[model samples]
Target: MDEFERQSEERGWATAKTLAEALPYIQIYDRETVVIKYGGHAMGETAVAKQFAADVVLLKLMGVNPVVVHGGGPQISAMLDKAGVKSNFVDGLRVTDRDTMAVAEMVLSGAVNKEIAHWISVAGKEADVRGIGLSGKDAGLLTVEKTTRTKRDPDSLIEHEVDLGFVGEPTKVDPKLIAGLIASETDDWVPVIAPIGVADDGQTYNVNADTVAGAVAGSLHAKRMLLLTDVKGVMDRNGDIIRQMTLSEAQALIDDGTASGGMIPKLQTAMAAVRAGVEAVVILDGRRPHAMLVELFTEYGAGTLVKA
Candidate 1:
């Protein structure tokens, strides 16, 4: 055979071997629910977004129920800029007022949510699977309460409450809509959720996407909650990724200051999901292609896994 043919043969063999190795891991997650918090570079970059959609479709075809909870921080900011709305952030959460909340809802639920579903539907066409876009407002999927944070005054050395108007925390998550779609036998459906929530007082609130994902995973008793962020994973003091840690170890990281900034919230969300009965939560770098598949189906795995 020619050199080209020989190379092709070798590639085909490698593909077969990889599939063979994935069998057991695939079986482990068959018919199981995995909640993926989709954002960061993966959602921003078009090529990565397409790849992500295809991967979600593959997971569904393999009998893994993948529920995607996506964030649109950058998109919302861009839209706000266009609309001449200035934003303020307090403690990393947007101080969303009435106008800000309207723009947020438009960007997250109206645009970003449908775009993700569109990509997934495009990818799943051949398999007869489709992506259904949803928000917390739809069918009462999520009911939230206003979120408040305390900020320390530099001069007074005291803390004061900061009101993040229209920002919410998930008080109740009703996963029935999601459960029904995934449990349907005749159709394969992947639910793509936007993080906009409604409050008991008939107000709309913008929630943190990671928080929503954790809440959804907990409600569904998901087999895994995959947090796709820009970072590789939770790093130790030595700057190495900690592959696995128990709940106490994770909490210690936060308590001892090993985890800081955005990582702190991610770890806290992971721990909360674990306490809520999620089997495990993995914080993986979404910029790396196929990170979810690697985490789910490979022995080495692709991120820091947190378990109860």
Candidate 2:
């Protein structure tokens, strides 16, 4: 055979080998629920967004129900800037005032949410997947209360409440709508959710996307919750990635000041999900191409998995 023909044959063989290896992993998660928090580079970059959508479509075709919860921090900030509204963040949580909340709602539910769904719907090479864009307010999906943080005063050592207006945490997540969407037999549908919820007082609140994803997964008793961020999973003090850790190990790391900053909230969300009945929660680098697929279908996996 010619060199070109020989190379083609080798490539075909490799493809077959990969499919053979992935079959068992595919079977293991068949018909299982996977909650993915898509953000960071994966959402911002066009190429990465296409890659992520294709992966989500492939998962649905494989019989895995993938629920995507997305964050639009940059988009919100950009819109706020355009509107000449100053934004503030405390302890990595955006302090959403009335104007900021308005901008956030518009960007998250109206723009980012639909854009992600559209990407998934059009990215499928084989069969086009249908994506349903949803907000936490849709069908009472996420009901939240106003969230508060306690800050200790320097020198005085007095604890005081820091009010983050229009910012809330998931108090109750009604998964009925999501369950119905995933249960559709004729149409394979994926839910793309924006983390905009409502409080008891009929006020709209912008919630942290990671926390929303974890809450939804726990509510659904999902098989896995994958948090896709910019970091290389959980790192040790020496700047090495720890492949896996139990809930206790993760907490210990946080207590020892090994995991700080933004990572603390992610780890805390993971811990909450696992404790609430999710089998495992993974914090992985979203910038890596096909990171979700690699973590799910390969033996090596892609990130730090926290489990009970």
Candidate 3:
């Protein structure tokens, strides 16, 4: 055989070996629910988004129920800018007012949500699977309450309540709509959720997508909650990714200041989901292509795994 044919044969054998190794992991996740919080660079890049869609479709074909909860921070900001609406952030959470909330809803629930579902649908069309776009407003998926934060006054050494207007925290999560879609036998469906919620007073609120993902995963008792962020995973003081940790170890990272900035909240969300009965939470970098599949199906997972 020529060198090219020899190389092709070797590649084919490697592919077969990889699939053989994945069998156990695939069996472990069969008929299980995996809640993926999709955002970061992955959502913004076209090539990465297509890969993500294909991976989700592959998971569904393998009998894994994948529910996607997506965020549109950059998209929302861009739309708000085009609308000439100024935005403010307090403690890394957007201080969403009336106008801001309207733009947020338009961008998140309408544009971003549909785009993700469309990508998934396009990827799964050949297999007869499709993506269903949803939001917290649909079928009572989520009911939220206004979120409040406290800020410390530098001069007075005092703390005061800061109102993040129209920002919400999930007070109730009804996963029945999501459950029904994934449980259907005739048609395969993937639910892509946008994090726009409503309050009891008939007011709309913009919720943090990470918070929404955690709430939904908890409600569904998902087998795994995968938080796709920009970073590799939870890191040690040396900045090396830690492969696995229990709940207490994760808390210690926050307490000792090892986990800082946005990572603090991501860790908190992971802990909360685990406490709420998710089997585990994995924080992996979304920028890396096929990161979710690597984390789920490989022995050496792609990120930090946090468990109760």
Candidate 4:
């Protein structure tokens, strides 16, 4: 590059860095929360996962409350396989029968939760990273009931009942106790939560982690909701990512089934956060190293941005 272009680029970065330095003072004590749904490629990839943890710690240091909620579908599946447990998925929901639920709890609460906590502490950040490993049974954090799925139109050929055995949805969310852990921290505390909800009859139910993240964020009235996944956020029909979109536009995309399959529920949960008064929602790829830092602190971020 020519000297002029090089100097221009340097100057631009210098200005941004200066602004970033000034950001804390401008944003201090601004009662805002951010819920991060960390999963998929991000959780599976080692470098990305640790970097994501570092980013969360940084956010807390910056006075931005980031509640970390994660899923361990891949890890759970692996453990179940190792234990010689047959795996099954009905309509994209895990058939969380008794044995499956036990493994899910162990992996999600025990393995995934603690790993995140350890990484956060080792990443040159001060975080009292607490692995608050829980299922829906404890604290009554979520109330879930059985789901009976059916077609959008009964007369349609594609319509049929999909029985997702023992899988639960986040029908209710209680953030009081969860918030206390963060707020009561004498030092920095990165609360790593596992997605499991409770049933009305005091039974435990396995819920989608994405649903858990959204409910937590909304319950906290977070400023932003960050969803880390495999794709580069919401894309157009032409395979181009839309940098920014409003809630209405995002809802339109979902209603039209442009974001179907597993993505459908994910988008719905994110939309739930925005509707509950978050400033924005970001759906981005977690494959890139330090993707969280780039997304949170710099321009040219990694994925689609959904706004309030």
Candidate 5:
């Protein structure tokens, strides 16, 4: 029994050692930016939050440039109610007036962005984190137009377009500042971006978290766009994880409706990034402890890997 226990311990240590050995390969892609769209259950849960912070620090220490983009829909909605402002949603997209958009910029760029930066620092990392939180309005970073929806109805038997007012898709992103950040002196500086893009006329548009990250990855031509979601990955009909696939395969799964529900949009964003020449995007479960570090540093990572 003692020998058996000794063997088990040795096996565990061997696995961990092997994972550490793989780190150098990952570092070869270091300073090569990877856009992580952080949100969902991971953001709300305390344990997940702390682990994510540690993960960011670890990534930076490993010489990887991690640009964190966050979502705050739940926070925004709560604030709006507190301010006695009426809110509306169209196809899971919030309808923002000028007032609401102002609140969004303030909250996303000011409060949430800084708070995340602070936490990332407090995680025992002496990072020179320059949290230049901006909406699309600053530096013409993101351009937006209204989101047009195409939905096929079961009863009506027709597909048509519906204009979701103030709901936007990012038409373009100005990557100048992002490039500048990666080129900055500090090896530990990580840019925490809040997902709000601006139009030509200096109007701020509320962009979705995934959309913003995808656009940034596209603009930077990042090696990876790692979306930190709650799920392990895209699951089949029986809810088993799809480990690896090409970008085309992911789209086909969506087309066949095999990947339905909330996973659709997330996978769609990943597909877009790959198509735009981002090397790959992985949808990993952020709820797991050290998932980000494990994914990047080890060959057998958690969740799905969508390659271009």
Candidate 6:
């Protein structure tokens, strides 16, 4: 064979090998539900976003149900800045006011949600691509309660409550809508959810996407819950990534102050999901190409996995 012909033949063989290797993993995940928290710096990149869509579509075609919950902190911040609104944060949660909640709902549900669905629809085969954009308010998918945090005084050593207006936590998750989408006759509809929930009094609340994904996974009893963030995974004090951790080990990390800042909330979410019956929770770097596929199908899974 000529040089070009030889290269083409080798490429064909490689593709076959890859498919063969993935067969077992595909079987393992078949008919299983996976909740993905998609956001962070990764969503801003066009190439990565397109690749993520392709991955989710492929998973569905292979009989794995993928539900996506996305965040838009940076986008909301940008919109707020343009609107000349100031934002504050307490313990990593945004201090959302009434006006801020309105803008947040607009950015998350109106813009980010549709954009993610559009990307998935355009990247996959027309016959199989059915991306449905939703928010927690739709069909009451997520019921939320107001969140309160406490801060300690350094001088007096006293603790008091801090109110983060319009910022809520998921109190209940109704999985019917998501389950219906997954159980569609064609199995083509994928749910792309924005983390905006509604209270019983009909107030809109801005929730953390990670929290929403965890609650959804727990409610669905998903096979896997993947929280895609900018970081590689949970790390040690030396900055080395921890591949796998048990629920107790993860709790220890948090109790010892080894895991702090943004990671603290994420680890707590993972712990809650595991306790709620999820098989596994992974905190992976979304910036990596084919991150989901690699984590699910590879032996070395591309992140930190917390399990029972």
Backbone clash pairs for candidate 2 read none
Pairs that clash in candidate 5: 136-196, 136-197, 136-198
RMSD of each: 0.8, 1.1, 0.8, 4.3, 3.5, 1.2
* TM-scores for the candidates: 0.98, 0.97, 0.99, 0.84, 0.87, 0.97
Over 4 Å off, model 5 = 1-19, 84-86, 124-132, 150-161
Per-residue lDDT over 27-92 for candidate 4, one digit per residue giving the tens place of the 0 to 100 score: 742445777888884586777767777767667766766678889999998899899998877667
Evaluate model 2: give its lDDT: 0.93
Tens-digit lDDT string for candidate 2 (1-308): 99999999999999899889999999999999999999974577788888889989999988899999999999888888888888888898899888888889999999899999989988764485788899999999999999989989999999999999999999999999999999987788899999999998899999999999999999999999999999989999899999999999999999999999989999999999999889999999989888888999989899999999
Once fitted onto the true fold, the runs of candidate 1 whose alpha carbons sit more than 4 angstroms away are none
* Candidate 2 TM-score over all chains jointly: 0.97
Top-lDDT candidate index? 1
lDDT of 5 by residue, 126-184 (tens): 55543445455667777887667876787998997765556678898888877887788
Q: How many residue pairs clash in each candidate?
A: 0, 0, 0, 3, 3, 0
lDDT of 1 by residue, 1-308 (tens): 99999999999999999999999999999999999999884577788889999999999999899999999999999899998989999978999999999999999999899999999999999998899999999999999999989989999989999999999999999999999999998999999999989999999999999999999999999999999999999999999999999999999999999999999999999999999989999999999989999999999899999998
Better of 4 and 6 by TM-score: 6
State residue 288's C-alpha deviation in candidate 5, in Å. Answer: 1.3
Clashing pairs for model 1 are none
After best superposition, candidate 5 residue 43: deviation in angstroms?
1.6
The lDDT of each candidate is 0.95, 0.93, 0.94, 0.74, 0.80, 0.92
Q: What lDDT does model 5 reach?
A: 0.80
Report the C-alpha displacement of residue 246, candidate 6, in angstroms: 0.3
Write one digit per residue (lDDT tens) for candidate 6, span 1-308.
Answer: 89999999999999899889988998999999999999997677788888999888888888889999999999999999999999898888899999999999999999889989998888766656768899999998999999988999999999999999999999999999999988888558889999999888989899999999999999999999999999999999999999999999999999999998889999999999999989999999999888899899877899999999
- Better structure of 3 and 4 per TM-score: 3
